[model samples]
Target chain A: MSGEPLLEVKNISTSFFSHLGEIQAVRGVSFYLNRGDVLGIVGESGSGKSVTALSIMGLIEKPGKIKQGEIIFNGEDLMKKSQREMCELRGNEISMIFQDPMTSLNPVYRIENQMVEVIRYHNRNLSRKKAVAQAVEMLRLVKIPEPEKQIKSYPHEFSGGMRQRVMIATALSSNPGLLIADEPTTALDVTIQAQILDLMNDLRARINASIILITHDLGVIAEVCSRIIVMYGGTIMEAGNERDIFYNPQNPYTVGLHQSIPSNLAISEKRLVPIRGTPPNLMYPPKGCPFSPRCSYTMRICLEEAAPTIRLSDTHISVCWLLHENAPKINGYSKGKIVDRYKTPSGS
Target chain B: MKAVDDVSFHIDRGETFGLVGESGCGKSTMGRTIIRLYNVTGGEIFLDGTNLTAMSEKNLLPFRKRMQMIFQDPYASLNPRMTVTDIVGEGILVHNIFKDRERQERIFELLDYVGLKREHANRYPHEFSGGQRQRIGIARALAVEPELIICDEPISALDVSIQAQIVNMLEDFQDEMKLTYLFIAHDLSMVKHISDRIGVMYLGMFAEVAESYELYAHPQHPYTRALLSAIPIPDPDLTRKNKRTILRGDVPSPIDPPDGCRFATRCPLVSDLCTKATPELIDKGAGHFVACHNV
Candidate 1:
């Protein structure tokens, strides 16, 4: 726990060479994940959260390529690994679960076949009977009722939530040190989402796996993540612990996101202040901060130059010109001000 | 086997009645049935005390102008080849409300109301983003000057920030035009924020119905309580403190749903009575209604 991080992504840039132009999906994104850390990367669609995950998994194909930077995992640079080496390390050391379980799973194969194959793939010497038993135990760990019976069912026979549970079981069957889940619950209903998230929390403790959860819902991040990374236009706008990002947010995009969503705790009398304009286009990304177009406190400098990462604390960092020393102070943008504003009830 | 079975509700003038449920719960079906997209197989639908279900196509032609729908997928709903002007002005031309330059002017005004520029009229739907295309859809719905607009998961396909903008615009339009809305969505938080009254549907039946605040604050039905508690609160502190009621398994299929209560298969408080007789929606006083044997 005191040594280097379990995974460190250093200034990685990924782009797709489209016919029109180069689509810069992940532009110099850097982050680290420690042992047992549940890091949530929160961003909207086209923000390149999924692309970053795919790049780390070495799954980016065709026009897409990881142009630069290193992905160090357990003292080894994953970027230097051969495709054969990556295939060996994928299920054995790192596991991933995708958004839609139906697509990720083979419809023709039974759940037992998928889980057994993954289990046996990681451990070449394991007997088929032992692998099947381990598969049943994994399904049982995820609280799937009648695991032995249900393991015989096809992917379509399972419900959306059950299929996701099966996916989690299959992902964890290898017992990888790192689990990268991309929008794991976005396709399921809220009630089932709660179930899957709860199961993840339970499994994280039991398996001791470090998780990188990627999602567009801030609420989901707040629910599970110990640390949060706010991404926009394929760049990290802010990275901090949950409290720093939620209660004492420094980035305008982070604050704007909190203000935009209607809180279930609060009644509906006041209008939500929406961030105007759409997300930045990646093909023709802005030279300065990606949020400068929609930022309420944008200055001339914010649009002219890219913002440097400002360290507010040991754990909190923000990429915004407003955090600069020479920048003028804006009301309600001060430290810990958002907590007071959200604490007060809007109305009954 | 009915998509929407034995559901009765009324929307008062200028009131937004939200219908919320998980996927395949018939909320969308209910919305379509109200707008006559799906013919009513069993029950009658009345609009302002007029029986819409009994009217013929020729007789219902005028009523069609009084009701319109905004679809969920902006990418699929809007005609790809049609320009924004044709998309919005088609209703005006069809209903013969305006013509030529006047029709064009009305289309421009509707675009402005929905936060689109005049120059956007000539561009096709493919050129616009999801949020912008939804605005175009809104403009089209408003062009007919419909009193009741059925928004079928309009903001579900949008991002959170853009969702707020669209919700705020819908609110403004409702206030300005005194329009009623049948807002159907699976997002509980946004639905609660925008609705006056909400109906909780499960397997083609209304499980709960009450004022929005009442439904959220003191949810009575077991299904309603589980659904509300399941929503992840945005505030970290609140989310940590919240004791969620995590339901087991997925919702049972609507086809040949377990006898009596549709939720009986998943309800934590299920009893023998719940398996034998379906509960009726009984008033729990203060305009709140719940359908459950335990309640």
Candidate 2:
């Protein structure tokens, strides 16, 4: 909305080549992140949210490749960078925290060794003693008590929440310009997840760093993100500010997701309206809108070709046939609630 | 070590009682123990006032037909090699609930009842999606015509939209058949929505037990209060405005847990008395129960 954004991912498509077929994980996803902005990418399994994050980090492994599009970070195209250059950028300028902390961390090594190594690698001029001290300071920033003493303990000694904190500390040790957290609080308890979310909010303001938080939980997204991208079947179904996405969601998939969760705190005797049918099989993905098969207001045109992106506002966009200018008007599908909720057919 | 200890609760004939806690909090163990899947080290479980713990394997056969459990992971719970027909009808055949032609018809009826087509009966578990697999699991569980169903995080693995479908289906079945349910899950919001009553477990003990509305509106236990506040409401404004009692540290390891109270280590209002003498679950009023020294 302001000056040049911190990171801009343009028309990126990532796919995995298997014997069965090419599984298009992320297809033509485009979004930008401004400095100090917390962007949330929300999607369920097979939505390709995680793959989009990996594509940005240049971490797509064998059989999986970024087919096209440029990843521009701080005015430079990251796709042009060599492997050596990408390695230097990772964990230094751009860091990522995964769903599980145990897998990313070294079990045998002490917390100090892992953190200091990351610190020193990004800043070679810093002495080991200074790096160790910096490591403890980072640990303290994440609110891990007794950082100096805890640094000597192995990853196994810490609890799930504590281990996640250590992971965050290590990731932020270099003061990375952008942080990408994929399902950071998914494995944690509700109380522990709240603590982490609060800490992340505090640290965001303290450091003024941009974050791309990828998660499936809409509640988690509401708690932390300023802007939200709702993904489905490897494509973005809707993109808007938190208010637009939550208060006035336009896309059928987005509406379906909202209706599915029991959000009202009143505890009324209301039943949930689940989106009928499973996600499209990516091996033979739809010829038209990815969510067309499961969408309630699917028009004949929706099954023939892709839905046109309708700009609801300067900051809100939804990809759905119902939002199109010439599309048939449907009643009672407004403000994220469907009128025929109970009687919504369970797919033909 | 006692996976579940000092936990006493009862479920009405046709009510859903939610058991909620973090991982390794013995919620699943409690569910399994009630269904007689796990051997009880201590305590007794009664189903319709009949002591299930006292029954031997030979005598337990009849009781086993009356209760069933739906697991958390749909991917892991179903047999990969088994056909849907066989999987759903296995229990029917085991208990001799139906004959040759009737069994086939019953299997198709079950598939249809769970929103699955009769054609899907020939497919393997690998052919179905997570939600469909869960339906198949539900069908298999229902095949025995059990009076009680233990849904152990049934919708946790499913997507948000699909979760509502499964929940609504369960509710519909509950109303139609009047089946009792032990809904065990970590997600508090859904639990509050589904359960008539809820039990909040910390380590091996319930911190609070009350009606769903009572538990959410006025949680008495210190642990329950913090937990209720911790849930990130879907509304952005409400979530931001809500003042959360963020629990400082991790849940203390259940192994060799503190003598007096398992939650004392992380409890915000923990007093010396809490660590010295264990608090008993005492009824406050209106069928509400809380175990806390401070409250």
TM-score of each: 0.97, 0.96
Pairing residues by index, what is the TM-score of model 2? 0.96
Model 1: how far is A44 from its true place, Å?
0.8
lDDT of 1 at B22: 93
Once fitted onto the true fold, the runs of candidate 1 whose alpha carbons sit more than 4 angstroms away are: A334-348
Indicate which candidate wins on DockQ.
Answer: 1
Q: Rate the local accuracy (lDDT) of all candidates.
A: 0.90, 0.89
Q: Clash pairs of candidate 2?
A: none
Query: Who wins the TM-score comparison?
Result: 1
Cα lDDT tens digits, model 2, A1-348, are: 478888888878999999889999988888888889999999999999999999999999989999998898999999999999999999999999999988888999999999999999999999999999999999999999999999999999998889999999999999999999999999899999999999999999899879999999999999999999999999888888988899988888988888888874777578788898889887788989999999888889989997666666667777777876577766633322221211221011
DockQ value of candidate 2: 0.79
Interface RMSD of each: 0.8, 1.0
How far does residue B26 in candidate 2 sit from its true spot (Å)?
Answer: 1.2
Error of 2 at A7 (Å): 0.8
Interface DockQ per candidate:
0.86, 0.79
* TM-score, B chain alone, candidates in order: 0.99, 0.99
